[model samples]
Target: MSGPTRRPTLRDVAGRAGVSTSTASLVFSGKGPVAPATADRVRAAAAELGFSGPDPLATSLRQGRVGTVAVVVEAPLREAFRDPFALAVLDGLADELEAADRTMLLVAQPADDPVRAVAQLSSQAVDAGVFPLCGIRDNPVVEHLAGRGVPLVGSGSPDGPGMAHVRTDEEAAIGLTTQHVLGLGHTRVAHVSMNLGLRSPTRAARPDDLEAALYLDAAGRLRGFRALAGDAAPVAVAADLTVGSGEEAGRLLLDVPADRRPTAVVCQSDLLAAGVVRAAWALGLRVPQDVSVTGFDGVDLPWLDATLTTVLQPGVEKGRALGRLVRRALEGEPVADVGFPVSLRVGTTTAPPPA
Candidate 1:
């Protein structure tokens, strides 16, 4: 064996193309002026030699910056991305990062063991970090990244000094739908909440539940709903953000005698609202006629027949906002917290309670 086959390098491509190695680098980096034909020749040679261009590690070292940003999500990748809103936010963040010539390094931190993320990130190098979604109120990663002098951005969780955020008034945002259903004369309204933290079961939420809530977004929205719906209102917490969890929460609240059932169900997310709608149908209940349903996060649900009444939060825009903040921080600009606004969208799913 001749010391294993050597991998093709930029020099190999440049030599094959009869050009300087610097010219080959310029072609890949898309910097500096080069003639069209010369660029074509280098590309052709690269193809012929199976050269994939410059090494990112070497380039980053030369630039004095890693072209990667750590995007911290609260759930497992499969579970976190299941929501369309989450996917949209990721898309927007990816778009903006691409514009800045940066890449996203996804880091999923389970709520049960948030410090695990700190450990995972200890060995990784990133120019910055982001909490792109709701997470625990007090994340250990915040302290870890802060100590490393890495700039941090978030959308309203893991709050601490020096971390810029695209903050949403969660209480006011949830109030949009809560007030909508209340305005529709649905007095016996029930609430379906996303899990307060990891391993939360699908069951009624007690007053003490809010005290122990790790997810601030869920807690804030719950408080908003309670403000309008009252302390004694029937509230169910989903085991997770999934439709299955929502459906289970729905059954717990809706699978009861008509007189005892809530006239409207205000859910914390469109996915959960859709699940509640499905559960209603399963219980032989007609939406609006029997129970009005409203949700937060006005995500598109094409499969559901009735459009949901929800808080119109533009997920992609929020993600872009988070990305822009990161870009500013990385560029040595003084970044500040940004306020993201939301609106209430009324849909056919919500109507006045039945006679």
Candidate 2:
């Protein structure tokens, strides 16, 4: 056998069709206008010669538009995607980017090495970047990309640069939730927060607060609760933001004797609140009757019959805003820091403290 017939080339098609090389190039490139008849002849020749088109590498180089956007997350990929709030936001982002025919490159970097992942923007090549606001603080990833003049948009407010930020008003949401508990005539309120670390933004970490480090979101919610209460907000940091942590925190809070116990508990997330409710029931306490409970993030939890009085922050909107920001950055437009609105959803979970 003749070494599997030799591959075809543009020159082969041009010669076979009795057309100039430039004419063949024009026909395939679709740049210059060519007579319809001539174009048809070139196509026919290419088909006969089994020629496809130019190399993809050459085409990409010529276009100079990579169809990829980097989405950097500071948390583990499994945890970030598994969480309902993160999933909703990602879904919204994927929808917008897919509509625009752009691809998303998910980058999960540990808090310690955020730079390694972000450096991919320059080393590898992406049209733009989208990071969660918390991930952008003095983050190495943000610093590298911003240094390279790469366009950036965030799902949350990145502290260093005034990049396009799309996030629900976490402060406002927590404030409303806190006020609800306070309004119910509950003076002794305890907040169960997720641990983000003393280094996280949202809360200006006090030297003493460092002993009870929590995540950035947790810190912010706690700060908001304190600010709204006009008093030092007593907080118990959960090992993490999970139902188990909430349960443990609940037990710890309630063990403080009825007189000293908080009449109401504010959890950082819906999952945490649910855990607290379970803990309360285990202690023979009825929700909102013996002890009131509230959660942040309007996530659905059917098991808890009590309406979860919480903040309805727009998770999908945050994702969409981040996608839009990436598109704007790709188009060479500047993005400004923007904050989304949050609403309070009153549920039966919260009530006036027992007299």
Candidate 3:
């Protein structure tokens, strides 16, 4: 008895169907114009030979395309999607990717052990990789995936060769609000920061934290804040992006003696700013009258009653920029870094120091 029957190949079908190999290939790939009768003959031969088009793996290996992109998010999906800004960015990215006839494979990198993501992604055959947001400056996955010759794109950080970025000047972006409050004559100012270091807790920022910070955006913003607010100005870091974390940070800076309390608070995100507003209300402080607050990312907060003085960086547009970069990189185009623009929008939340 025979060990097994030989598997079918496209060439076998082409030979049996009495058609040129290229014509048979066109019938399967749908890339070129083929006569209906000839296409029917190829399909009939394929059916007779128990063939079902080409093996996807063999096709991809030949074409250097998996037709899928790995979207790496440094936080768990549950935690990452909680932030509206993050959701908007993801939405825009999804839209652009769908239009390109590409599929997105979201890879959530654990906050505690990012290296685990490299292990998980090693088995996946992706055409490209995307960080897509401001995340850890030094990521292990960057080197691992780059070694496999996958093109990479992101908004900031996890930077390296074979990677294109949609750049944002985080320091200058943070300064837009920092300067706004300073211009308003608020001397006793404070800041609420997102996590400066990975897997860190909510607390006051320390010198050690600044040096060891892996999140490039947060570090840049802190540096920008320190540049204007002096080295000794107070900074309370949030545990995460939630309003609760923001509130905790807010109370740290605001729950103090009238003389010691900051007259103004500048937060890193709109969610944090909203929390600060809540914290101020709990402490019986009138916003913009007793204590002014400002936030970054002018994301829409429909439930919040007050407007935030924030840096207007459109998350959707930023995501689209990242997608566009990825598209260009995949098309064998010479990729270069593209700058993403942001502007300041003043609102109801900021004012001069209370006399």
Return the top candidate by lDDT. 1
Q: Sort by lDDT, best first: what order?
A: 1, 3, 2
Residue 202 C-alpha lDDT in model 3: 84
Candidate 2, residue 93: the lDDT equals 87
> Candidate 3, residue 295: CA error in Å?
1.4
Q: Across residues 1-355, which tens digit of lDDT does each residue of candidate 1 receive?
A: 5688788999999999999999989999887899999999999999998888788888789887999999999888998779999998999899999999899999998888888898999999999999999789999998998898999999999887899999999998999888888888888999999999768579899778889999999999999999989998999999988888888998999999888899999999999999999999999999989999998888989988999989999999999999999999999999999999999998999889999
The TM-score obtained by model 2 is: 0.82
* 178-292 per-residue lDDT for model 3 (tens digits): 9999999999889998887766678998878778888888889899999999888999989999999988888999999999999999899999999999999999999989999
RMSD of each: 3.0, 4.5, 2.4
Local error of candidate 3 at 179, Å? 0.8
Q: Please report how far candidate 3 places residue 133 from its true position, in Å.
A: 1.7
Question: If both were scored by lDDT, which would come out higher, candidate 1 or candidate 2?
Answer: 1
The CA lDDT of each predicted structure is 0.91, 0.74, 0.90
For model 2, the stretches where C-alpha displacement exceeds 4 angstroms are 1-56, 118-122, 198-207, 210-216, 303-305
Clashing pairs in 2: 133-156, 195-214, 195-215, 196-214, 196-215, 197-214
